[model samples]
Target: MGQAMAGAYLDRGYAVTLWNRTASRADALVAHGAVLAPSAAAALEAGELVVLSLTDYAAVYAVLEPAAGALKGRTIVNLSSDTPEKTRAGAEWFAGHGAVQLTGGVTVSPAGVGQEESVILYSGPRAVFDRHRAALDVLAGVADHRGEDPGLAALLYQINMGIFWTAMLSYWQAIALAEANGLSATDILPFATDTSDSLAGFFTFYAGRIDAGDHTGDVDRLAMGAASVDHVLHTMADAGVDTTLPATVAALFERGMAAGYGADSFSRVMELIRAS
Candidate 1:
């Protein structure tokens, strides 16, 4: 991702100074008119605005700590993934070194960087963000400034990832079930895609009701949903496919049923999840 971001900037005619633990990893960028900094400190000192695309906050400290002296007047944009708490702590750490930290959450893969559809969430001091907005826009089509809180970007990123992983896993489970029934994944592609696409409508319909704490079951009932899940579980079991995913889902629905939400909307299961 670091390489991609740097490449994006270099393509835009920005003077980029590249540095990595393995210096050879930046050979291509170096050939493209980007200066290859000899050390992390040199990279930090190269400009007032420093963009970091490390693995996590741990790696951020590992690289920056030894180069602390160069950070005093720099604004560090840390796009690494980590917990919100760690992000907040990192902001404080940067402040202690007389540097400003702008937290970022890149929503697209490296290949998507610099694309018009790509998004990057940011959070930090409003003034700092406004100052660098033009430069940041080079990295993504949507440089979404989430809020003044430095951790908001990380929080939203983690929440997005939570949905991403679970939704992808559900797709995988569907593919497995289809394969067990002698159907290729290609055969189920349209149906799976249609079902996945329909979720946005459901989410839109349920958001207001959920926010209002109204699980009236007018649209759907927990009892019916649970029964449907039961059929899915049994079908997978009969197909000789692993049932772990559906089993876990069925168990959750069963718990909701046992908790007397059987007559309510399945959305009421949110209560059970919250208590858990």
Candidate 2:
């Protein structure tokens, strides 16, 4: 994610300083006119606006701890895959140490960086964001302010990961089930790709219904959908395929059926999946 954002900043003519604990990682960026910060302190001293994209919360502190004095009055932009609590803690840590920090999420892959298709998100002082807006735009066309909470960006990021994960899982799971029926990867690739592409729109549209807590049978009714899923399970089992994913879905459907939602839409089963 850091590489993606950095590539964008470089593309947009923003002077970006690059660094990695593994120095070799910066070689490509350095070739692209990004000056390497020799050490953590040098990196902080090198730029007033610094961005840290590391592995986790612990790594954040490890990098900053060595450069505490160098960070005075600087701005820190962190775009790590961290939880919300970690984001809040890191933001507060930077504030206590005299840096104006911003928590951010990058929604684009490395290839999407510097293009309009990617989005970079921020959460912190709106005033600070306004001041830095021009520089941020170099990374993506859509750099958004989420809210006052520094954790909102990461929260959104994790939710997005769920969409990606389940989509990928659905594809692989379908392929696995088909392989049991003598379908090779090549045979299933086209259909899997096209079908998953079609289903991709469902997350967004269905998510609205899920969030609104509306189980109105807008598309397919629950009982009918459950019947279709039952077919999938039976096919998998008859072909000696493992039923882990379908089994979980069946569990949810069974719970929904018990709750008298068997006649409702498939999305009404969201209640069965909720923590409560």
Candidate 3:
């Protein structure tokens, strides 16, 4: 990701200074007009706006700790993946060194960097963001500033990851079911794609009600969903496919039903979730 990001800057005629724990990892970017900094401090000193694209907060600290002195009066854009709480702590840590911290949650893979459709979620002081907006745009065409809170970007990213991983696992579950029934994944691909695409309408319809704290079952009831999930669980079981994911869904629906939300919309589970 670091290499891709640096390459993006270089492609746009920006002078990029590259550094990595394994210095050899940046050979390609170094060849393509990026200066190979000798150390993390050298890299920090090379640019006023430093971008940290490391593994996590731990790695970020390890790399930046030695360069804290050089960080004074600079801006640090941390694109590393970490929890919201850790991101908030990191912002405080940077502030102690007189450096401003900007949290960035990249929404695309390294290969997608610099693509027109790629997006990155950012959160920090609006003034600082505006100052570097043009340079940040070189990394992705769509850069959304979520809010002033440094953790907002990480929070949003985790929420997205939660949905994405579950939805992807559900697709895998469906594929396994198909394979067990003598239907190849190729045969079920179109249907799976259609089913995923159809959820957009459900989201749009429920967004207003969800925001209004209205989990009325006028559209769909938890009882109905529980029954449907039961059928899915059984179908997967009968097909000799793994039932772990479906069983987890079934448990949640059953819990909602038991919590007196049987006649309420499945969104009512949100309340139970919040209480927990």
Using lDDT as the measure, which candidate wins?
1
> Which stretches in model 2 have alpha-carbon errors above 4 Å?
200-212, 217-219
Output the better candidate (1/2) by TM-score: 1
TM-score of model 2 (CA atoms):
0.88
lDDT of 3 by residue, 1-276 (tens): 988899999999999987899988888888899999899999989979999998899999898898888989999999998999999999999999999999999999999999999999999998999999999999998999999999999999998889899999999999899999999989999999999999999889888998999998888999999999999999999999999999998999999988999999999988867855
TM-score for model 3?
0.96
Best by TM-score: 1
Clashes of each: 0, 1, 0
lDDT of 1 by residue, 174-254 (tens): 989989888999999999889989999999999999999999988799999999999999999999989999999999999
Candidate 2 lDDT over 138-185, as tens digits, reads 777899999979999899988888778887887788878778878888
Q: By lDDT, rank the candidates, best first.
A: 1, 3, 2
TM-score of every candidate relative to the true structure: 0.97, 0.88, 0.96
Model 2: lDDT to the true structure: 0.83
How many clashes would you count in candidate 1?
0
Residue 28 displacement (Å), model 1: 1.0
Candidate 1 Cα misplacement greater than 4 A, ranges: none
